[model samples]
Target chain A: MDPGTVGKLIAFCNNGQMQVPAPEPATDPRRHAADTWVVIPLYNEISVIARVVGELAAYFDHIVCIDDGSADGSAASAEAAGARVLRHPINLGQGAALQTGFEYVVGRNEADYIVTFDADGQHRVEDALEMLDLAKSQDLAIVFGSRFLDDRTDPGWLKRVMLKTVVWVTNLTTGLRLTDAHNGLRVIRADAARAIHLEQDRMAHATEIVLKLGRTKLPWREYPVELLYTDYSRAKGQSVLNSVNILVDLLVR
Target chain B: MNVMWIQLLLVVGVITVGLFLARPTGGDSHLALRRLFMAAFVIVAILSILFPQWLSWLANLIGVGRGADLLLYALVLAFLVFVATTYRRNVATNRKLTLLARQITLAQAATEDSASIHRPHEGTSNDDAAH
Candidate 1:
């Protein structure tokens, strides 16, 4: 299927949903929201994590934040904002936090889907909700959010080049062609999430997750989603030089 | 200039070790092989120190110039092997640590979840009282 048409289709569906005025509770597309868990691997984002969790709590009934031993009270802030907080005693990498979240969600019998979100407030809740809807409607086991599907997200030229290189490397390793590899928004069904065993504990886990998920041979698709590259997120973004570390981590293992 | 036999041997040895490092390590057999290699190295080191002339004679047979040069080459190869083994060990250790930390975090979260479920209303009342 052509991604261009799919992108336009998504835009059209979004507009259709917006035009609806006071739909009945029975007709709400988000009726299954209770079965979806939003897993956020939070770090030292005390400033914005409360707002992020609060925004997610509006749509998702279950929001779990894995606090990787933040020096700041980010965990408490997330808890106050109505999220289930899991605290790691020591600071592990984001990948480790993600794995922990997956395991925690998978242990519960009620969870049917996991939406991996970022704590930096770059990801849009509407995008996550749409991805989850696409997954359910299409019977997809995974829905990856891609920024390059449209021109809405414009990371700087250098950052774009670096991200494209990462996409190339991820495709080479995972045997799955994806427009964006490092976006922190993904919708993984419970079955697909159970298959992921991420050994890479650092930034390399992004590629590792794709590699493991691809090995499952489950039905997957890329959904066009715009990432809000705010100043806070930009400041916390990965540096180009860090790609060397990611390469080494992936190769050595 | 013709390449000496020692140069060819060193190149082949380094290449073989590099390829070996790339392979997934076997558990018991790999440990046994490493121990055997260490034992052989110790014997050779003692022999070289005890009879320096014998070391030079052996080095000449291998086309190396002197006993010191042969020892230097061996030391460099041993250092590389040490680095490779240390790196592998570190990766394995990190994996174990990650699993342990995850277990602890999950257990704590589960306990807190049960506690809140049992006294669900008390938590909200405490929050309201604090506010």
Candidate 2:
């Protein structure tokens, strides 16, 4: 695996995220990055964290990168890239990292919006910003970024079928019609986002989020986004069995 | 084909996994009970491997239909109990470990730049949305 690509993949590492970025001197409220906390769960993405976080910093101010016990200096790279870095003593799943980010924002009560972004290069910064705006303008509680919502990109046949199956299962269990069940980009309101506490410490958290939000009065929408599926990301993407495990986790736990 | 071979293969494969699990590591207290338990299984498994007909003979005396059937029933029951107990322990351990990791992350925040932790956002407007 390309170290940089793989580094982005495992960022499924989330710290008690949702850290408010230190504000810039002066900026437009519409474009303000501070009150919007972007949670980045990072594991061993030492190679690409700085670049990804740096690109994210262009739009949002407070970028919290959770380092889930990486042997490499992933946290350091994110910190250097103007993100607040939180450290986990051991490797927890990406779900735990996002939980940490959510809890941090809840604890501080300083953020207005919390955005969950993938550590993988698949996520586009432009898409995140647009989803953030849609969530705010439409007064929606959550804006889930869906690769299938629009035709900007294709995640390939096998991936499409896998994701569709996940979406189907998620909708069946949650009773919510979501175009994408496990895309890593999500923008949630502070209050509504706070209710999304994750117990599933692995990829199941994605489905778990759908279930949690579906039970609430939270209004949500799916925004179309693009995912750059390189040969690396395609190969490194989740195995089909992980979906079965996710289903079992959701049903049992 | 003789069913004995399948039973032998299954037991051998399972024992290989057991051997890996029983490999010694540093700082682990040696448990005599555990050693004894595994030793008993090893002996029984070897006995079954060596004397396949003995199980059927014993089973016949106990009114069981066949030796392989008796052995399979015993193995399945044992496996079920073992899985149930092991799963319970694994869940508990995972919960405790997750809590520890969560605490470690919550208690500390790292920034690339020194003196960046808790650096207040300047002239920040209202607390974004939620009060």
Residue B29 CA error for candidate 1 (Å)?
2.3
| Superposition-based RMSD of candidate 1 using all C-alpha atoms, in angstroms | 5.8
Q: What is the interface RMSD of candidate 1, in Å?
A: 1.3
Output the worst ten-in-a-row residue range by lDDT, candidate 2 chain B.
B21-30
Candidate models: Cα lDDT each: 0.86, 0.74
Model 2: residues >4 Å from true position, as ranges? Answer: A1-30, A251-253, B1-63, B66-72, B110-131
Model 1 spans with C-alpha error above 4 angstroms: A1-32, B120-131
How many clashes would you count in candidate 2? 17
Residue A75 displacement (Å), model 1: 0.9
* Cα interface RMSD of each candidate: 1.3, 8.6
Residue range B5-112, candidate 2, lDDT tens digits: 555655775665455344432123434544666798899889989999888887676556798878876787568547644654566578778887887677664232
Write candidate 1's Cα lDDT for A1-253 as tens digits. Answer: 4676567556646653222211112346456568999999999999999999988887889999999999999999999999999999898899999999999999986799999999999999888887877788668899898898778999999999999999899999999988889999999999999998888889999999999999999988888888999999999989999998988887766
TM-score of 1: 0.88
If scored against the real structure, what TM-score would every candidate get? 0.88, 0.70
